[model samples]
Target: MATTSESEPTTVETPGSDDQSREGEIFDLLSNQRRRYAIHYCKREDDPVTLGELAEHVAAWELDKEVAAITSAERKRVYTSLQQTHLPTLERADMIEFDDRTIELTDEAAELDVYLDVVPADSIPWGTYYLGLAAVGSVVMAGLWLEIVPTEAVPELGWATLVFALFAVSAVVHVVQNRRMRLGEMERPP
Candidate 1:
């Protein structure tokens, strides 16, 4: 006869539970402005910049290659972030090769850098721009659609003007609704 014997517990440990660190792995891959700058600095350097120099360089950071000067404390954070956080995580993914002296992106990482690599400072999604255009189009289209002047009746100037004004009001409503849709504020009722 088959019998129920025992059940093992499922223990979820925050650390040392798995061979990988998910949070670290992700942060390594999705580099922000500062992290990318660190990588760029390493790639461009002919020699290893000391932690102090790196720290200094990071402080006066204006995203300029020809920066004026570096500060003392900024160098420390740069070095620590580069070492404990950036270098090890990148090394695991083969994004960069690290030795005692320095760290740099691997040939593969550099080559693959062309795709989904870094977010440019000025980059803006085209969807937002197109949506703004759509708002303007809705207004113009609504105006033309109203057709205040009926060819059959040939209404008097005052009546036609009043109708045109009403049409213009409708156009304004169209523009407002379009704006809401573009912003994802339109709700579907259940």
Candidate 2:
């Protein structure tokens, strides 16, 4: 065994520590709506965006107004917050490159695309929709098993095929919608 001095420090690398840390950082960055909007704007732009332009659009989005209609005070408030807090945080996370008032997304920002699915407040979650579909299928199967409907009208194989088709169609639509909802995938942020 090697002798160790009390003053020496040992660093151990734990499996998945980097992943866990990265996940933590991502969640923390996304916790704020302003940061989310900033990321959204960056993703939508092919070229690096000036901080002033970022602030104007963010203010417009937050205020639910056109960019020209946004008051100076509103723009200033969002600008200060992003400059002092959100942008720096994003820069440190390596999700964005910030330099000399210009902002651009890094490769890590693309990784965040999967997490940016925007589910509207009024819409049902995908999980609930799938559950309802399953329940309806089960009920129909039960009815068929009980012979409530004539087998002459629809055979067991036909019912099974119809159910399978329904699920397959719904899954395809769900995937398409999810892709549309991801950041930068659409003309507007979802």
Candidate 3:
């Protein structure tokens, strides 16, 4: 039997090693709501923003208040929080390059957008939406089967075929949209 030297290291190939590492890092960086908000604000910018401006916007968003309505106290609170805590955390992750004066996003940080979802407050979750669709589809199919609805207007097999096609097409569209967002090529729809 041959024994390997203790000083020698072996390389192991883990499945999706790089992607998994990146995904974990993204989750880490975005763990905090404040950090997510910072990324959301930064991702839409055309240029580097002053820390003050960034703080103001972030504060407004956090408070769910208008920028014009933001009080001096609110501004100061957010500014201090970012300056002392959040900005340093993001800087260490290479998500953003933050100076005492101005802040800018890094290219690596752009990849973070893929992991963040921007769902509207009023909308239902996709899982719930799909469940509702399935329920309605089942009821419609049952109606067709029992002749609760007119067969002359639409046959049972024909109705089921159309419903399945609609779902298949909708699923395809949903997948394409998800891929686009996951690639960081598109922002979440408002």
lDDT of 1: 0.51
Q: Which ten residues in a row have the lowest lDDT in candidate 2?
A: 181-190
Tens digits of lDDT, candidate 1, 1-190? 4455468555557766453574455454644545555554555563455544444455446334333444445556666776777667667777677774466556655533333322224744334544655666565455445764354554455554655666577668556544443211222100
Task: State the TM-score for model 3.
Answer: 0.67
lDDT (Cα, tens digit) per residue for candidate 2, span 95-187: 999985999999889899766656878888888889999998998799898988567878988988888999999999889888888876665
Colliding pairs, model 3: none
Q: Each model's RMSD to truth, in Å?
A: 13.8, 2.5, 4.9
TM-score per prediction, in order, is 0.43, 0.87, 0.67
Better by lDDT, candidate 3 or 2:
2
Candidate 1 runs further than 4 Å off: 1-28, 31-33, 42-55, 62-68, 107-125, 141-190
lDDT of 3 by residue, 27-104 (tens): 887777777767666766647888888788888878888889999999999899999999999898888899898888
Q: Model 2: how far is 182 from its true place, Å?
A: 1.3
True lDDT of residue 49, candidate 3: 82
Would you list the C-alpha lDDT of every candidate in the order shown? 0.51, 0.87, 0.76
